[model samples]
Target: MLLLIVMVNSCYVPSNLRTVVFSSVNNNVCKRLDGDIVLYAIFVDSKFTNPWSKYDIETTLDSIRVATEWIEQKALEDSVDVHIQVAYHKTLQGRVPIKNDFSKKTLSGTLYKKPLWSGVRDIYKWADKIAKEAGLSMPRDTSPITNIKNDLKNRERLIARLRDHYQTDHVALMYFINNYYSDEISATFDISNDNNVEFSIVSFKNPSVIAHEFLHLFGAYDLYLTQYDVKKRDKKKKDKLMEMFPNEVMAFAHRNLSSLNISDFTKYLIGWKKEMPVEYQRLLLKKGYFTAKY
Candidate 1:
């Protein structure tokens, strides 16, 4: 059983950090210059209808290390000096099944939307219970997303538990399960607030996918446009990504590090660069995201 602790301060906003709220719980938690960031990575052995075994996780450990190393190397390249520590949590099982089957309603073409934050919250709660069973205390400080009334108490409880259990600035979850079509997602909560708990979930142990999703927690946006974007994205146009970002990891996960580099736009979002580049700002504006002069 997970004990719920109420944090007096619903959100903790750092004075030097600025957050942009995409939704109630999803916020861009950007790092300040030279700030030390600790990412607690957990490998979750989930027991869905088609579950992932301990053996599967064991095999994937090497790939997970590769993914984290990529993150550290990228940060170093930009002089961010991020130190990411990957920790393994006890295996979690017998929770609500994450349906692999997708219907048209659950997805808008290639973009998936079935298991929203609500579903993710359920898994988080289960994981919290497991962590507590293993003797971890929930932190008393947590920040709630502004204007989001749905499941606010539960959200607060999970965040508090994660902050205390991980004892780190950030948390990332690698949910290893049976192979599926759509694999990775970054879950960001309390984007514009302090003490935000951000995490990423990967269905499989693909290093490229892990790195891409991990960056999302640190305020990186998807360079590839989905159906949700106002402009129709052509999946067939491989050249579109190469032309725009060349070797950018966020856009071209298949490319090796030698061929890939962090883009200025991503650097700005993740707090490596204080201000957005003029060209990037124009791109965002053209994409229908309003930019207020800072």
Candidate 2:
């Protein structure tokens, strides 16, 4: 199992040196700037999702592959030694998600709810059930484990199955939910493992949306302020992304994938850059910012 040991203390890091490591780093699955970061997508169906077909699966997979190519090309121009590997498995059945006035009356009773996760734990547990039965590489089932003996085992098994299949520790698991009639929100939750896998829930098959959410899992932050913004400080950075970098993928996912590219600000968050440029510091943070060492 891969062990992430994080330690933090005040230290002066050299600005331009790629070798200068962080005193404090995020303990998440999508770490490291270089090498292969597996993008293992789990194709799942739901009441709100379109039924999967052989053609839909192939086309969707092709879109995801194209997105990976965009990221790899951007990393190359920026000199970040990284490549994205794609793999996937389709679920045997459709799963339910916890939503207000939807499945709430049933699943909302005891299911965990958090703003960050948006209660995706329910979705993951249900989907893993199918993948596990399919004999595919999936994360360990950590649902309702009351047995004390299995607590530690469940924790270490963390991403055991996925790690085994990829034969590499750096893997970013994603769930691609096919679109039906209504559009669903796409998000990436970084719940740094509490016997769970930190993954992304993608509702649309658009290459831009796929690539944008994938980058979020690795550590990139949304530059454009959205309707989800509630904090006053968050609103302060409103539309700064659009004004500064109109072609940034994180800012506008609706744009053509060829027109969008990753900015230096995103490069730093995903561990591709050593430090943030002084000129672009105010775009996201006001009280200044510390480099989020991954």
Candidate 2, superposed: residue stretches over 4 Å from native: 1-26, 90-121, 127-131, 134-158, 191-196, 284-294
Total backbone collisions for each predicted model: 6, 0
lDDT of 1 by residue, 1-294 (tens): 101111112332323334322221224333332344444444433323245555665666777778777777887877777776665544255232232322221111112334554544455454444334322223234346444322324333443455455565344433343444453333333333455444444544567666666666565665664333454433433235447787787776655545667787767656667566666564543444433322
What TM value does model 2 have?
A: 0.72
Regions of model 1 farther than 4 Å from truth: 1-35, 42-50, 91-162, 165-167, 182-197, 230-242, 255-258, 286-294
TM for every model, in the order presented, reads: 0.61, 0.72
Candidate 2 per-residue lDDT, tens place, 202-232, comes to 6677899888887776666676765456788
Per-residue error (Å), model 1, residue 85: 0.4
lDDT of each: 0.47, 0.59
In candidate 2, how many Å is residue 20 off? 15
- Candidate 2: the clashing residue pairs are none
What shift in Å separates residue 94 of candidate 2 from its native position after superposition? 17
